[model samples]
Target: MTFQGSLPADRAQSYEEQRASPRFALLLRAAKLVGAEGEYLCIVRDVSETGVRLRLFHSLAAERRLALESAAGERLGIEKVWENGGEAGFRFDVSIDVQRFIAEAGPYPKRPIRVGVEDVARITVSGETTVARLRDLSRQGAGIDIDRHLAIGQHLRIEADALPEFEATVCWRRHPSYGLVFRQLMSLEELAVRAFRMQPGRLR
Candidate 1:
C-alpha cells in the first residue's frame, strides 16, 4: 500500500495539539531511524518535547514503532505519525527534555555517528595488501578486521568496491580488528547513503 501524500486533517489536528510543549528546531541534524527491517538515514528538521519532524531519503517501513539514534549514539523511542513526500513526523514515546536532547547531554561525551557494516575491503600497507572486512564506518574513520597485525601509526590505503579509496592511519588494534582514522572526512549525506548501501538487505 502507498502512503498518502498528506496526513488526514483530523490526524493533522491531533499532531498540532500534541506539540503543545515548547518546540526546538534542530535544522538538518543527521540521524538514523531504526525499524524492524533495518535502519535508514534521516534528518531531524525540528523537535519538541512530544513530537519531531524528520526528513527522509527513502520510504520507511509501515511499522509504527521505531527508534531514532543520534550522531552521538543516543537512541530515543518514536512512534510514526505521518509520512509524505520524503518526510515524516513522529512523536516520542514519552515527553523528552528538549534542552538535554538538543545539547546531547548523555552518559558519554558526544561522538561522530558510526554505522555497522560487513563488506569486504582491501587494506594496503608497506607494499603489501590483504583482504579485510569493514566492521563499521563513520565520517572520519572506519573499523576493519584483518588477519594480520600491523604497527600503530602506519599510514595505509583502504580500497573497497563500494567506497572510494581512503588514506588512513592505524589508530587502534585488537588482534584481527583495527581502527583507522581517515585523512578526509565524508559529508553527512555521503556517509548516510554509503552506510545504507553497506548494510545487509538494504532497502531497495
Candidate 2:
C-alpha cells in the first residue's frame, strides 16, 4: 500500500545498528493467542533479532502474549508491540544477535557490484522544501543530495522507492548536495532490494 500522507518527523524510532544481512526462516502458525478475552488462533510470520511482524486471524489486544516458535521447533516468547488494523508487530522476549550470525555465515561474500541509485527523493521540513537523491548506499548509510544552506542539525524526512518513510538529520553538506545517515537504517528486506539488483538470483 502506498502512503501519501503527512507524518510526524519523529513518528518512528531511528535505526541505530548497522543493517543485518542474515536470512533466517520464519513460520506462520495457526494457534490460539491468549489475552484478557481468552484465546484466538493467530498466524506467526517468521522471526528476527529485533521483533516479529505477523498476520493474525483476529485482532489482538495491546500487550498480549502471542506464542512464537523458532524454525527449530522451540517455542519463543513474544509480546505484542504494534497492531495495524489486523497485522501485528511483536518484540521477542529474547533478542538474537544477528550481527554475530551474519559474521559466522563464512567470510562475507564479495558483493558483485555496487547498486546505483539515481532516483530523486523529495524532502520536506517545517514546511520548507528540498530535494535529494540516492547517490550511494551501504547497509550502514546512504549518500544523498541536498543544499548546503540547510542547517547541519536540522532533521529531514525522505520519500523514495523501496524505502520505508524515515527521518534523517543533515550530517554532511557540500554545496548543491549533502549526505544524511538513515536516522532509521533500512531493514533486511529493504537492503535486499539493492543487494539483489547488484547480484541477480542471489535471493531465494
Candidate 3:
C-alpha cells in the first residue's frame, strides 16, 4: 500500500542492481496522481520507459495501484515501487515511449496562458448530454459554465468546434463553473496556433 520512505537497505541495493533502462531527468512538468483518496498534483522528476519518479508536495497513503495523468496527456497505471521523503518512484503497467513523451514537453500551466473563448460545447456523461458554455481554454483542460451539477471525478466527453472531441474528468467545480482535465492533452503550440488563426468574429 503506502511507502513512507526509501526502500530498505537490502532492497535498495537490489533495486539498483536490477536497473535495465536509463532514466531521464524531467523539467518540473505537472501531473496528477489519482488514488482512492483523490487526485493530487505532482511534479515529474524523471522518467524511463518502464517507470517514473515524482516529487509530491505532501505524503499520501495511496493504494498500490494508481492512475497517473501526465501533462503530456499520458494516462498510466502505475504501482509504487519506492519512496523517499517527498519523492516516489512507480513502475508503469505497460512500458511507454519515453523519448516521444519527453519531447512533447507536456501541457501549459493553468490560468497563465488560457485563452478566453465563448463556444457552445456538449458535455456527455452516462449517455446524457448537456450544453455548456466554454469560458476559457488551455491545452490541459477547459473551464466551462454549465447549469447542471457535476460531481468531481465524473468522466465525460466534450465536443466543440475548433476543439477536438475528447474524454475528460471533472477536476474542479464552483457553482456554474467547472474545470475538466482532458484525458488527452493537446499540444501547447497546436492550441496557440489554432487560437491565433480563429477570426476575430469567431471569438465569443
Candidate 4:
C-alpha cells in the first residue's frame, strides 16, 4: 500500500517511532565499554520503554556499547543512536523499570516565567560553573539557555536559590539552548511548590 504525508491514524500500530515519543526526566550514567574512554555521568528529560536521550559533558563514541547505570548504581547495556559534539541519543538494550520513578515535578505554570539564565546556576562536569537564567521550569526539570553544548551523558551540578543544587545530564541541545533532566528529584511536591512560588503563579 502507498503511504501519504502522514501515516493513517487507524493503521498506526501500538508502537510509536523512537523519535516521536515525548521526553521525560531520567537519571542514568554511561560507562565506556571499550578503549580508554572514561565513564561519563548523564541524565534524561524523558525516556521510552526502548530508548533515551542523554547529555554528556565529554565526547562519546558513536556505534560503541555503553553501560547505562541507574541512580542506585544498577547497570544496563545500550547502543548509541546518534551523537553530535556534546549530545546524543541511545536505545536501551531492554525496557526499563518504570516504577522506580516518582513524580516530584510541579504542575505547569499558567504563564511563561520570565527569568534570566543566571537565575538557575550551572556547574559543568569538570567543576566549572556559570549563572544562567531559567527560560522554563517544571517540577521534573528546567530548561536553561547556556553557551555550552553538553554531551548527552555528561554529568553536572545545578543550583538555584529556590531549590538546592543538584546533579543532572543534558538530554539534547538546540544550539545555545538545551534540555536538562534533573538527576536528583527526590520530592515532586517540593519541586512544584518551589517552581510555582518562585515566579507569580498558583499551585495547580
Top lDDT prediction, candidate number: 1
Q: Could you estimate the TM-score for every candidate?
A: 0.85, 0.37, 0.48, 0.38
Q: Between candidates 1 and 2, name the one with more favorable TM-score.
A: 1
Model 1 alpha-carbon drift over 4 Å, by segment: 1-16, 61-64
Give the deviation of candidate 1 from the true structure as CA RMSD. Answer: 3.1
How many clashing pairs per prediction, in order?
Answer: 0, 4, 0, 26
lDDT tens digits, residues 7-55, model 3?
8898566456435668898867666666654445567888888788888
lDDT of 2 at 35: 39
User: lDDT tens string, model 4, 1-204?
Assistant: 112235455424322465565546655322222212323434454566666666554455433577664433345677765666556666667776544422322233232221212245655568678766666554456677877667776678777777688778777777677767776654433543454334422222
Q: Deviation in angstroms for 66 in model 1? A: 2.1
Model 3, CA-based lDDT: 0.72
TM value for model 2: 0.37
lDDT agreement of model 2 with the native? 0.51
Among the numbered candidates, top TM-score falls to 1
In order, what lDDT does every prediction score? 0.82, 0.51, 0.72, 0.53
Candidates ranked by TM-score, best first? 1, 3, 4, 2
Score residue 65 of candidate 1 by CA lDDT.
89
